[model samples]
Target: MSGDTALVGCDFSSAPSKRKSIVLAFGRLVQDRVVLDRLERLPTLQQFGDWLAAPGPWIGGFDFPFGLPRELVEELGWPTDWLACIRHYCAMPRDEIRARFAAFCDARPAGQKFAHRAFDRLAGSSPSMKWVNPPVAWMLHAALPLVLEAGVDIPGLHAGDPSRVALEAYPGLLARELIGRRSYKNDDRAKHTPERLIARKDIVTALEAGTSRLGLRLKLSHAQRDALAEDASGDALDAVLCLVQAGWAAREGPPRWGLPEALDPLEGWIVSA
Candidate 1:
């Protein structure tokens, strides 16, 4: 957690989303301020795992669900063991899983399709019990094994490699603070308008000026800045946002629950697991 640790912000995708892949943004805290280091786009879960396993002094704040709600796991009788639980979760076909989850939501009263805890909205931008929104299911699928393989001890969840610490981070948590309801990114070429570019510039300026509540200061290279602006699409800029998140996580240090700790085992980890 001390030197050269990488802060990572992940832009997660919902299931069946080919657009959904883990984007790794690298950064470190210098003199209590966050600084951008590098950026990489991980196109596959396996590739992300490889990056996690790569040797380095790094702690990542990934945009993924780190835990599940205790109630859901208990009620459904799913395995409490972290790996086993995720294995079961990932094993089920997407359609079946969605159907079951939808049914569960339907059973609930209106305005409560998914159970929610107060912290969910505060941190993950989702109800604590939602399987979508932040897409905790996909987060679980992408992150669990990598942490275990890294040998981190995620207390209350399971033990794993100690070198790597993965925490749940939602970019929206930070984004909302700077630009509420303003779309800063769009993958659709048709929607890449001047308005969105202005939003991106605003975000970039705020980061450079250290205006965000996270107290992070983003440092971008000339090339990086040019790349972010030149590309009509916002993919590069989005990656920068993700990078800022990673920098914040590295500065914050490891999860209190343990390196490999489960977020909720049912509800999932929203911000920090």
Candidate 2:
């Protein structure tokens, strides 16, 4: 493995996720080429935090909301301090949180029931504003603190530790680029049909060959390749996708892919940072 690796992809699960706590993949860039190195499955947030604090040359592309819009935070009177705000958010009971958000939405104009950041429209839907996505609310609840603790600056989102850098990413951005609305992963056993397995293989091939439009590639050992292929469901594969994004971020540098300097502190960036 490259000792001074660059990017990592995290397939983030919101709180109470049935998925693994965190799936991290490592990568490096050589002569402008992106290579995947390692993929690790962390079973808890503590383990993930420990990894972040460990000594190594790395930048991470985590799949979580790095910030809420300043407008929303101010409107709700949430704490301005990132860590304090997240702690208060995590401590709130789900019902109360939901009710408050609902009230906030209800008070908005009829045409705009849910509050949206500028990027929300580009990203399809905002998980922060939805409930069915499950523990994502909690993901936002749990993750922001770690980002703050890591001290990675997120432009408008955070004032982070200078040593550890973090960028927001979504695997969907890359996946959609490859498959274009075709379903690639399913926890449902019924949905893990042979066709999906073939799709997984093709996706893997594209990643390994560095043919995807994301301008990235994956490096995997024979064992890792077999492991991904043998899994009947695509949970592991999806995690690998997150890993690829992570690898990209690590290699591409902090808040990788040219994240804007003046992003809305509350409204987070997607893959760029």
Q: Lowest lDDT 10-mer window, candidate 2?
A: 249-258
Query: What total of clashing residue pairs does each candidate reach?
Result: 23, 21
Per-residue alpha-carbon lDDT of candidate 2 for residues 95-114, written as tens digits (9 for 90 to 100) = 88888887888898987766
100 Cα displacement, candidate 1 (Å): 1.3
Which ranges in model 2 have alpha carbons more than 4 Å from their true place? 1-3, 15-19, 79-87, 106-112, 150-156, 231-233, 247-257
Model 1 worst lDDT window (10 residues): 257-266
Per-model lDDT: 0.62, 0.65
Q: Native-vs-model 1 lDDT?
A: 0.62
| RMSD in order of candidates | 3.7, 3.4
Candidate 1 lDDT, 1-273, residue by residue in tens: 666555655554433233545556666778656666666666676676677677765556655566655556666788877677766776777677678777778887988677553357655456433556445665565566566676654533565555555556666666667777788776678888888788877777777888876677888787766667655555556556655665655555555522234345434454431
lDDT of 1 at 6: 55
